[model samples]
Target chain A: MSDLFPEEVRTERLRLECESVADADLGERYASMNETAIEDGELAYVPIEPFEHLQEARDFVAQREDRMESGDAGTYVVRPRDGEDGAGYPAGEAELFAVWDERTAFMTFGLRKRFWGRGYSGERAAALLRLAFERLGVELVSVTHLVGNENSRRAIGKYVDRFDGERVGRFRNQHVIDGEPRDVVRYEVSKADYEASGERPDCEFVEERADGGDGA
Target chain B: MHVGVANLDCLWENRRVHTGVSLYRPYWGRGYAGERARALLSVTFDRLDLDVASVAHFEGNENSKRQMEGWVEDFGGREDAYIRNAVPRDDGDAEPWNLRSYSITAADYRDAGGAPEVELDPENVPEPTSEPTDLDRANDGGDGA
Candidate 1:
């Protein structure tokens, strides 16, 4: 897992690049994005609190780097490849958190308000799933979203199969949204299922090296 | 003779735990396994304050599967996943055994009237033996199903 990190994944329109300590400024921007309400009156549901200062953002990046180094998690920043004027600086982030036994991982993705409705969420999520199933050799990937989060439900529904009914257990009132207890719907996608579906995203992963050589 | 003991593996971050129980062959038909499971479930949900609990049994282990299903019916639990070829058999040459996982939440446990009071009668309890018996030999199969 450590050898797989610090790599670059290129989708058709988005670049899902691994995050490092050098991306502290981008982390600060992400934190700021979460602090403000979006156009839909929805606040980003983040496990951690919004960063109060640049130092906090830097700390967050540092911790993420440590987790990546330990092979416990991976974080990627989603951005446009062309870097055109109209293109956003950094759309949002995608993560494969809580990797266990090299076979299972928890996936999450978020996009800023300005970046929504541009098909960026689905693109980044597909690329992240490729990274999990192809490069990381993970067998099962699980995701959970707030029940009322329609945007998240739609985005995640495109990439994975729903694991509700008798197939998966529900965690009732696992989160509190707007001072009310909300159930989180759990979803999962197995490597076999993903491979059988024959729905591969147009993505390529390139390993980066400390030297000036392309580690493909 | 003593049958088996049920235990819990604590996973606090997910607010969940894994339950395991193994019984000797001589005590298989008896209700010792179920009795032990009830006590462990009480400790897991009532005392530990966990959100969910899970258990798994290997393929071809009908007795173990039946025991787990009984808990699901009692606690309104669900069969989570049917993991194919997940558990390897004791013999390396044998095909890997499929795994069936079941999970129960604390809310469901309460909805099923919760764990019953487990009473132990000292007079009926079997005394521990210093020498290894058939129970010890049976337990050598594995930690749990």
Candidate 2:
């Protein structure tokens, strides 16, 4: 793990573990979840298509681990603390990747279909924003979603507004999704703006997983 | 005379283009930057068919601030954001640049009368003559007005 972030971070209702390739269970579950990510248009806005095979997903997990080891970015597996269905089975993934040259970082996350509509995005966003501003000491933290993703548009809008961030603009052709360029809506919160906005959602850094054991 | 270079950089997966200029100190306030910017806007909207054109200037750069503001006002754009520590320093000791950014969409460009009325005809050229040209006079330190 990068020294910038803890092994685990938590919001009020969610626990995000920094993902690693060494965690065989996580790689297996992550790959399985992504295999059907495109079903029912769940990952339509995401740039990559559904993972055709396990190796593709495993390769992705290894890449994320490499990014963390390089000290440039961190990817985490998000799980619910207390839920009846899919409580702790890699409900989603959240990441805070630094744009080191800009002294900034960007947030990205995606949830499984069963995990949607619960405001978990906002929850993880709070933790990630806290990590970006307080832990990483970055100047700005940004989040972007496809222009047509209404769920993300609402979720990100609500939290970013709460954090006193501004809508940078709707940038065109921001991503190439399945060989077609797509637009993205971007929002940003500078450290000064985030601090001036005062506390909103609270987050905590933890030395161990919420389960008090290693490797989900 | 190789006074400067103008740039239109792509951003957002080639959806938008950001304009910039680097002029020699002696050519700083000659309105050349403005002329180049107008041409770039034509390329951005009229020729390239891009959706947006953006410009940014580091904080405390009055010349760039004025220039960027002029484009925003003339092109019916707005100040989009104030980004802090937006660019890292190469010197290792200096601080990153804070930027004031602005943008104009295609619709806004059209509302602002679209591209300026500047035409180019490089294919039609006049052969050089012995008569002194205005550029030659300017090179000789004359006003060339």
Largest DockQ belongs to which candidate?
2
Expressed between 0 and 1, the share of native interface contacts present in candidate 2 is 0.40
Error of 1 at B98 (Å): 5.9
Prediction 1 TM-score vs. true: 0.70
lDDT of 1 by residue, A12-112 (tens): 78766665676446454555554453345535464555556667667766776677778667777676667533353566677776444335667777776
- Candidate 2, residues B1-145, lDDT tens digits: the string is 5776666765544467777877668988888787888887887777667788878899999998887788678888887666666778884246778888788888888998976585644574334233323444334553323
Q: What is the DockQ of candidate 2?
A: 0.29
Task: For residues B10-41, write the lDDT of model 1, one tens digit per residue.
Answer: 65555666778776578887877777778767
Candidate 2, residues A51-111, lDDT tens digits: the string is 7777777877787778778888777878887653666667788888997777889998998
Off by more than 4 A, model 2: A34-37, A82-84, A178-183, A196-202, A208-216, B10-13, B45-49, B90-93, B105-117, B120-145
User: After TM-score superposition, what is the CA distance of residue A93 in candidate 2 from its true location, in Å?
Assistant: 1.0
